[model samples]
Target chain A: MSETPTLESLQAALDAQQAIFEMHQSMNMEVFYWWCTAIMFLIHAGFLAYEMGASRSKNALAAGIKNILALVVIIPTFYLFGWWIYNAFPGGFIPAEASAALPWSQSMGPDAKDLGTGVFWAAFALFGATTGSILSGAVIERIRVSAFLILTIVLGSGVWILGGAWGWHPDGWLLTKLGYHDVGASGVVHAIAGFFTLGVLLNLGARKGKFIDGVAQTISPHSLPMTLIGLMLIIVGFFGFLGGCIIFNGGDTGWTTIYGNPTNLSAFAFNTLMGFSGGIIGCYVATRDPFWTMSGGLVGIISVAAGLDLYDPGLAFIIATCMGVAAVYFAKLLENLGIDDAVGAVAVHGFTGVVAVILVGVFAAGTPNVNGLPPISFMGQLTSAGVMIALGFLPGYGLSLLLKKLNMLRVPEKCEELGIDEVEILAKPYPEAGVPAIAASDVPNKLANTELQGA
Target chain B: MGTSITTWENVSAYFTFADNPMALGLFVAGATVIVVGLIRSIIKHENEAFKQHK
Candidate 1:
């Protein structure tokens, strides 16, 4: 026997349903951002494996350890000042509204009232750390761990965060005054990291025996399987990285970019996939090499990233393919100049990133910015690119030069030839299986004996 | 009873926060752990240099 609902009863029922709906929506938003942050972990894992495999057998352990340490050190520094800087300097050099992000701020901690802030901050922190890892691979085999950690902190938690504030934030000067638009941080993250690595590489110089008599020599990776697998993980992680770029509004009301413009995840999905395929195909066609073909995929995504929110999938694909071709050729140009990139990060991330941001200006001309600002323009995007180069390159080159002068940058020439792993790690990655007198137990004693002999 | 125009208050309400002592304590604890761990790592890495010169 159902009662016919009076007006009051109907109203009560509606209120209950609305409350439940609100709760569900709140939880879903938190879950979405958490998932994005979790997925971004693969980016670091990929970097670890990718760097290890790229390094020669003698320096593999050293290459891998520095990456882990970078993550360890950058997390705390980022919390201390990096998050604050993002909110503080969005207006450019002025610490406007930085209180909300201070380390002592209640909102920055684990609180029942806020479920979203920590996850969001974690995602951005991952972005900063990714910038540090990019420089890590280029200067591997020669760099001391302590010196590398110092540079990592500067780039990861300091310089890169500053770039993000000026370019990616909603109130950023680049967005407000210049009408700059970069949906996927091609300039802020990728370009800054890529060029910063170039700056450091300039100071670090080529590895020993790399360019004898002014002729370049190719140093091959120890394991292609590991490198390829690592890259695939990075591709998977990128899905999460791009997801963080869009803010989720409650329910089906849709999402917005950091710039407060309306966008949809469907558009991002289409462009990312098409761009990735185009890059691989383009690289395969140009170099016909496996490494370049795979790296082309990364270049392709970066190439199309700035325009991802607005591009037709076909257009995204075309742009990515062209960038892929350019990345391989540009890498060759750097090599000819005797710049040993070790993994072609400069061409893949830096050059393609700059080109992509500029392309967005040409392609997305007249697209309206938020708050009734003028449309996105060529000069705005170009100016942002120029700023990123200055922020990324100058400190990288200058500070690394300073480290070199202090004798804290590179290992001694003898140490470089003997392998960073043996010199620092005190262990080998792969021990010979069939050495009668050389046992695992003898390693420490052997190390001690050698040390005593040297002394 | 009200117009549908969005104001600064409405927009600011979209950002979430929790101003409580428990949350503050959690931030301090997390930070302390990271700092301690970093110090330990630096000590260990530096100590290894005594074993080999090349």
Candidate 2:
């Protein structure tokens, strides 16, 4: 203090302060990621409500409970091993030398030292839950709760996580080798979920009375209001789900571009609203049905989700619109094939997700990689999308077939006819209606004299 | 012990005292409503069961 501080020393001190400031900024971003991940958990609630509403009254409670329970199983299992798989499998089948992010790993828990792991793990878990929800809708009324619960565990915790590890991770082999770029998991999440549902459907077969002599019958939802409410919630939750991925980058020189430039919330807001509007209009025009119209909203967002970060609002809207229309027709096509997807999960999630992956290539053709490599190309995007569909569908179908052979995939025909609620649950949701009341006089007469009862 | 309580306080403070408190509050309110809905559902179930028994 006595000597006037040298310019070099002052500069050094300023540099140190700047580094500390950057550290704090990074920590703030980590906090934001955690909050966003938590918000994404609402999507599960939305799915639960949506699927329950979509299911017949006989299977409503079962559908709701199954979707919720998938999370309970997925979270712990994923925590234990799922995180490791994501880091390990990015090279397709090969295991990488990356540090295994196991549940018991020191980095997993609340660590002031490393802030990224917790939020990232949570984000992946939300994706897993979404995958499970997609399967829950397809096999609602006919499937046993126990069997479906097991399926949820396998798909939510195991199969989907592995796929994410292989393809979704930036360092994943699919991305590194094939130049794959599914920015928001169109293929990794939705396509995989859809195919998995298809696999289960092949084994589970159609719900009783859904097919009569090789012809499909329509079973409409009991409550449209509930379904609409559920869809709205899903839309709201998706903002958090998709936005979380973008906001979580560790070093922000203040809202950097996907490739580290500079961005803002305004861009996301513009794209999301436009995409949603386009999807709604597209579905309405294509299907002329209110149900498909609502479903179009999901398709629209998912279709554009893979490239939303780079896309202009117009592009986002157009992609979303096209995706919505495609999802409706694809769903109809599946139904025509005598595949009874109770909630059209396969068509909406799988088909739209695959399309979105391809669209990303076209739309984000020249967008620079965050790692400063070449921009993602159309051919590269298609190849990656194809790989995901093949990987997801083949194993999923094979596993379902194996489960069917073991008599574990679907309930018996007798059980399906009696209703899964009556046979498996041992507790009817609507006990009064399910158990018809016998008059006291009639009951006594039946016991005393069979002939009197007949008369 | 002091540190733990302080950490909790810090977390809580981040939530309520953030910019765009209305949006944050609405999100929290939505969560609370879902929770309350679940509780109401359980209570209704119990009431229905009791009625059936009666």
lDDT of 1 by residue, A272-389 (tens): 9999999998888889988788888888898988989999899999998888888889998999999999888998888998998999988998899878865799988888888888
Which residue runs of candidate 1 sit more than 4 Å off their true CA positions? Answer: A1-13, A433-442, A445-455, B1-51
Backbone clashes, candidate 1:
0
Output the worst ten-in-a-row residue range by lDDT, candidate 1 chain A: A437-446
RMSD of each: 7.0, 10.8
Interface RMSD after interface superposition, each candidate: 5.7, 11.6
Q: Is the docking of candidate 1 incorrect, acceptable, medium or high quality?
A: incorrect
Q: After superposition, how far is residue A247 of candidate 2 from its true place, in Å?
A: 4.5
Candidate 2 residue lDDT tens string, A1-455: 49788999899999999889878877888787777777777787788888878877766776777777677767766766677887777766777865637443445555555556777788788878788888888888766555666677678777777777766665666666656666567788888888888877877888878889877798887666778788888888888777664644544355643334345667667777887888888899998877778887888888877776678999899888887888888988987888999888888888988888898888777665666544678988888787767766776678777767866666566655555444444344445553456622211122455666646
Cα lDDT tens digits, model 2, B1-54, are 112223543342222223343554465466445544554553354334333333
DockQ of each: 0.15, 0.03
Q: Fnat of the models, one by one?
A: 0.24, 0.00
**Model 2: docking quality category:** incorrect
